[model samples]
Target: MPLSLLLSLLAPPLCLACGAAAQVHQPLCGRCRGGLRWLPPEQAGAGVPLWAAVSYEGPARALVRALKFRGAVALADAMAAQMAANAPPGLLESRALVPVPMHPARRRRRGFNQAKEIAAALGRRCGLPLADCLERPAGAARGSQVGLGREERLSALTGSVRFRRGAAVPLRALLVDDVVTTGATFAACAVALAHAGVRDVGGIAYARTPGR
Candidate 1:
């Protein structure tokens, strides 16, 4: 039997946005999915041109929270699907999807890196390569970026990012993240990639904090 059919027989699927009956692999019901506010291609900040799949609001927010904190691994593929659907033109044309790396200790405690999860899913769906180009030091400080000013966040992150040793950086790449706030983290990552010989840097996040 097909995997989707088998899974459906085991448990009826529910919408990721609202707990309503949903088809196999469909995380959001029509109403909730229609409510998502996809941003325009030009709506990017920081020094790099970025594209976010959805505003960090409503169903999108709930979806990201589920993936980031609640261990909803299946949602990674769903979110990637949304990203692929909403991606700007030429996004998939990049050499590979480079996920923002998590600190080793935090990733160990969490048992996974959400950004890598999302990037892997996106790569599988879009046929793009997955590049684990950047990494954070195990000793890097781990704390919330919330409530910090842009310069403060940048200062906290500076010199903490480094390109993976022995990995050849692409000339152009898309930095994948689950969320983008002040673009501080993205800027830091782009800087590291630039130092590693990556020229053109772009980004794709599942959601962006609105009104920032």
Candidate 2:
């Protein structure tokens, strides 16, 4: 049998949320996908205008957890579709799609930067150039930010990221991430991109947690 089929037969793919049989390379089944609540864009504080596809709840939250923690990388394609669907008008015209960078150590532990995967998928979907323009300091501290408030996240992430040297940064770029919580990471990325000479910065994420 083909490897994929063999694996599926041995360990049938199941939905991350409801344990239903999952489609090939997808974390959620059709019914679980239908449970992802769409969220409309609104003014999220300064720096860059942000757009998000779904609220960080229900099946959307489970999908993100699967991608982030369980190495269900294929879900990136699904998440990218949502990102593209919720993209702000004219954002598809951005010069490049830049993923929020993870510190090299953290990325090493995770074996992949989920944001980069999501950004690359989004770029393919939207036909925008993909760029790895930001680099988090290798020694930046690591911890769960789940309970931290907005200002706390900003304080923790302060001085944590900078533009990668010699990386091409376009005049207008869209920062991409799997989720947006406090917007601190996006704000920091905008500052880094601005320092590297990007004139305009906008952001897109698969999910957002309101009032975080």
Candidate 3:
């Protein structure tokens, strides 16, 4: 049997949100899924049009935290499913998905980049290509963005993100992240891609902080 099937037989899958029994293919129970506060389509207002699957609250927030902090990498597929389903028409067409790059030190500590995992899953579901071309140069600030205001986050991120040297820059790219709170990260990445000759840039996040 497949490993996933064997694992399920050994241990039934549980909801990542509310700890209820869940379907093998989904990480959230029906109730938690229904409780998700979805957001309408909106631009990043940071020169990159962005779409988010849900609001960063309640079960949605729980799911993000589980994936980011608890290393529940399997949840990436479930999050990507929502993003693929709710994405605006033509958003994925001919566009490369570029995950927001985590600093090398932080990635080492976390063992993986949550945004890259989400982007990989999203790319599979959307049938799009991924452009893993962005990076945070050495000496860039690696402070957490949590609780930081928009200006503060932007200031810290300015000149911090850049496209990898000699990597093929895509004509149209969509930046992917687990969440969008202040939009500073997306804006900073857009600037980097633009500097690298990317003509069109956009963003997609699994969740958006309310009122952001």
Candidate 4:
């Protein structure tokens, strides 16, 4: 048997949010999943138009924390499912999914890029192609944007993100991220893609920080 299958038999998966037993394919228990506060169709107007699946509060917040900080990568699929379902009509169709790039040092320390993982799963569910064409060069300074304001973030991220040297730039691109707080990240990414010849750029995230 595969090692993953054997491990599952020995110790069943547990909910990342509440620690209750969960199915192998699911990261949250039914109750926690049901508790997510689904948001109405709303867009953050900071940079490019962006849609979110749920408010970044309660179970939704917990799930994002688990996936981003606790290494519970399995939750990406569940988060992506919600994003795919809640996406605006025609937003995902015919557009390449571009995961917001992470700084290399941060990605190495975290062992993965949560945005990329979420975007990968979202692509599979939405029938979109993954355009891993954006990147943050190693020369750029890396800092936490946790407490920064929108303008502050934009200033700090300026010139830090760029399109890869020779990757195929899609005609239309939809930026993907695990969370959208002030939309600075999406804006920065959209700018990079636009400079690289992508005509249309939009964004989607699993959760959006409430009140931003």
Index of the highest-TM-score prediction: 3
Instruction: Give candidate 1's whole-model lDDT.
Output: 0.87
Ranking by TM-score: 3, 1, 4, 2
**Every candidate's lDDT:** 0.87, 0.84, 0.89, 0.87
TM-score of 1: 0.92
Worst 10 residues of 1 by lDDT: 1-10
Kindly report which residue stretches of model 2 are placed more than 4 angstroms away from their true locations once superposed.
1-6, 9-12
* 1 versus 2: better TM-score goes to: 1
Q: Which ranges of candidate 4 are over 4 A from the true structure? A: 1-4
Residue pairs whose backbone atoms clash in candidate 2: none
Candidate 4 lDDT tens digits, 16-125 = 77899888788788988888887777576575888888989888888899898878676798888887777778887999999999999989999999999998998899
**Which residue segments of model 3 deviate by more than 4 Å?**
1-7
Backbone clashes in model 3: 0
TM-score per candidate: 0.92, 0.89, 0.94, 0.92
Worst 10 residues of 4 by lDDT: 38-47
* Per-prediction backbone clash count: 1, 0, 0, 0
lDDT tens digits, residues 1-212, model 3? 86756877899888877889998888889999999988877656466789888999999999999999988787899899998888888887899999999999889999999999999999999889989999999789987778887789898998999999889989999999999877889999999999999999999999988886
Give per-residue lDDT, candidate 4, residue 90. 86
Pairs of residues clashing in candidate 4: none
lDDT for predicted candidate 3 compared with the true structure? 0.89
Q: Is 2 or 3 the stronger prediction by TM-score?
A: 3
